[model samples]
Target: MTKIEKKNLAWGYLFIAPAIIGLTLFIVAPMIFSFIISFTDWDMITSFKWIGLTNYQTIFTDDIDFWNSIKVTFIFAIVQVPCVQIFSFLLANLLNSKVKGVSIFRTLFYIPSILPFVAVAILWMFIYNPDFGLLNQFLGFFHIPPQDWLVSNKLVIPSLVIMAMWMGGGAMIISLAGLQGVPNYLYEAVEMDGGGRIHKFWYVTVPMMSPIIFFNAVMNLIGVMQAFNEAYIMTQGGPDKHTYFYLYMIYQAAFKEGHMGYASALAWILFVILVIVTLLVFRFSRNLIYYEAEVK
Candidate 1:
């Protein structure tokens, strides 16, 4: 390589060296270790012994709770991710419009997202309490009978979904930034073509904001799929394991039951599932995600 080109490459590597080191030490090493651990039986008390594929086989064939956890995670992902994304996008659009005290409102909405997850989960736990909780009291005014939220198997997942949506304002702020970055000239040109609000939005806003939407969708998908803290704090996977998400189950296996090998296998399975889902999203988004260069 040319001397200047080599220097430029050296500078680039220097700039990125810290990040590379951090990832290798914190992420890559742990991941490799975890994969190796998945093939052995280890309880933190005894030496790990190789067990072949028994742990994985048990998860697929014998562990009913494993399957149930998968079902719950799938349902949570299906329901919560789309709802959170749509709500966040709509809120972003509203905040993006010319409005008084928009900044104050944005800050208020985003506070929940910035708060620690444990705090948020605990706060929601109180709000969802069947007796003397705000939600129950509000419903009581309409003569609706108090219903167990976190305690009810039928309602636990949905309750958690609501909590997730409430704290989704951080994502809304990001979407608003994306919305603001969209060139106003696109809207102006569409208006010059005699386009109405719906037409302008359909042709301009959605197409331009699609990349942001795809990003948020993928993030929310990963978040919901690996949901643990909410279910752990709120219901403890209670009410018949109704809210027991995949990651929660993994925790229970590894920490609670001392089945580290089984939990590691489950973790790998989750990793594969997330990879496949992310790839599918990118594949499908190719046709939908719009680039400015493609528009003309």
Candidate 2:
């Protein structure tokens, strides 16, 4: 190789070396260690004793919370992912309009997504307060009684769904970008074919934006599966464990119960579930998603 090319290559490696090193030290190393530890019983008080598949067996057969966590997590994801995606897409459509001060509205909407979840949890807690919350006060104006939003088992999941919609501003921005990228020429062509707004949207816009929509949905699914901060900070899986997510279950096992091995097993199980689910989603979406490059 030429000296100049070799020097540039060295510089490129130099620039990425820290990232590689950090990943190895922080993420990859921990993952390997956790996998190994999942097979051993270690409570941080005693030496790890190898127990084969006992931890996995216990989770699948004996522990009730594992099953409950699976149900709760899947239900939460099923509700939250599609709702958040649809809401975000609608918001993106609105924000994509040529109206004045729309950028400000977009910014206002997206601000929630960037805020720390702890802060968001605390803010929502006040809003959900039965006695003097903004939501209750607003409801009072309409003569509606104050409701136990976070405490009631039936209302808690719905309350989290609402919070999830609020945070979907990030997805809105993404959708807006996708909408803007839809070719104007295609829309004009649709108009020439006597297609109305609905026709254009259903045919051209949807097909063109399917990739972005699919990508966001996949990410939303993954994010919902890994959900932790809100349940942890706000409800602590309260009101009869209605918000007890799988990640929270892992936290409880690892930190609260000090069952490191069991927690590790739970984590691995979650990992496998997410992987399989993601693959299934991708498989199902294969025909629905439109890629322009496929034509070429």
Candidate 3:
């Protein structure tokens, strides 16, 4: 290579060195260390003890709570992903329309997404409180009975899902942007075919918006699957472990119980599950995601 070429290459590496170093230090190296730690039995307070596959064996055979966390994680993902995505998409669509005061409503809908997650969870906790809470008070005005929003097993998961909906404000903004970009001629073509609003939505809007939908769905799925803060701050694994998400269990082991090794194993297991689930979604989404470049 010429001297100039070598100089350019060196400069390029110099510019990107910080990013490479940061990734190795903060992400890649820690992942490798955690994997190694998973094979041992060491609470942070004690010396390391090699346990081989014992942690995995115990989890598979004896740890009832592990299975419960797995169940709760998947259940939360399944319920939250679609409901939040669809609701946000519809809300965004409404906001995108020529409704009066839409700009105000759009700002209101997205304001929660920027708030601190802990603060949002605390706010929802107040809303869900049975006595002197805003929710029960509003229900009382309508003569509806006060319902246990978070304390009951049946209500806890749903209450968390409702709280998660606040985080979907970002998704609503994305959907709004996608809705605005949709070509007017496409809707006109649907109208010419005597299609109603449902037909236009199903044929024109959804197809045009599929890429945005797919992106939001994957994001929501991953976020819900690895849920922690809502369960931690509000339920703390709940009245009956109904909100005992997988990540929360890992946190409980590592921090609360000081079982760092066991927690690493649990974290790796969740990592594997999330990877497989995400890959499966990508695999099956071949026909679902529509890009405008395809037409070009």
Who wins the lDDT comparison?
2
Candidate 2 weakest lDDT stretch, 10 residues? 287-296
Query: Worst 10-residue stretch by lDDT in candidate 3?
Result: 287-296
Tens digits of per-residue lDDT, candidate 1, 131-211, equal 878899999999999999989878887898899889998789889999999998989999899999999779988999998
Q: Write the per-residue lDDT of candidate 2 for residues 18-59, one digit (tens) a residue.
A: 999999999999999999999999998999999999999999
Pairs of residues at least 3 apart in sequence or in different chains that clash in candidate 3: none
Model 3 lDDT per residue over 18-132, tens place: 9999999999999999998899998877789998999888878999999999998898888888889988999998898897898999999999999998889889989999987
Clashes of each: 0, 0, 0
RMSD over all Cα atoms, model 2: 1.5
Instruction: Give all candidates' CA lDDT scores.
Output: 0.90, 0.92, 0.90
Cα lDDT over the full model 2: 0.92
lDDT at position 54, candidate 1: 90
What is candidate 1's CA lDDT for residue 80? Answer: 94
Evaluated at residue 147, the lDDT of candidate 2 is: 99
